[model samples]
Target: MTKRTNYSKEFKEYVTKLVVLDGRRIVDISEELDIPYDTLQKWVASYKTKQKEAEDNRQNALLSASEYKDLYEDERRRKLELEEEVAILKKAMHIFTLEKN
Candidate 1:
């Protein structure tokens, strides 16, 4: 029986990136990296899947950030409007008290 080989994380990542992102074919990458074709294909598939998941997460983060910003701006506008209303009511009360005197 032959021995099974285990690759390191950095090496596997490098192989995956070269083949999946850089458009290198599995057979070519396997020849260049001296890895098995089946293993290289598996790495490429996994890398593509992970890359898509990462992009989706980034988009979600951006959307959440924009939503928070909009909510904050709305709260600020509401506070400013309430302040103006309170000032107007105070002025009206002062004028009524003067007229009553």
Candidate 2:
């Protein structure tokens, strides 16, 4: 009997991304990753299905135009604030990582 192998969630996600986002052939990825062809195909299908379902739900749950505009404005403001915070953190990290002469 062959031993069953288990993959981590991050590995599975990376595999799915390679096939779904990178538009790579399942056969090629399967051979390169040393994973079973059918297993990789099923993982890609599941990822695509989830993406489609999320898109469908998002389209179905649309709000009024004005509501969307208001929500968009609020989200845009929050995004800008987060980006500023991230820039500050990156600068702080750069300072911390610098070598002292």
Candidate with maximal TM-score = 1
lDDT of each: 0.87, 0.94
Candidate 2 TM-score, C-alpha based: 0.61
TM match of model 1 to true structure: 0.65
TM-scores of the models, in the given order? 0.65, 0.61
Instruction: Report the C-alpha lDDT of model 2 over 1-101, residue by residue, as the tens digit.
Output: 96689999899999999999998999999999899999998899899999999999999898989999999999999999999999999999999999999
List clashing residue pairs in candidate 1: none
Any runs in candidate 2 off by more than 4 Å, and if so which?
A: 64-101
Model 1's C-alpha root-mean-square deviation from the true structure amounts to: 5.6
Among the numbered candidates, top lDDT falls to 2
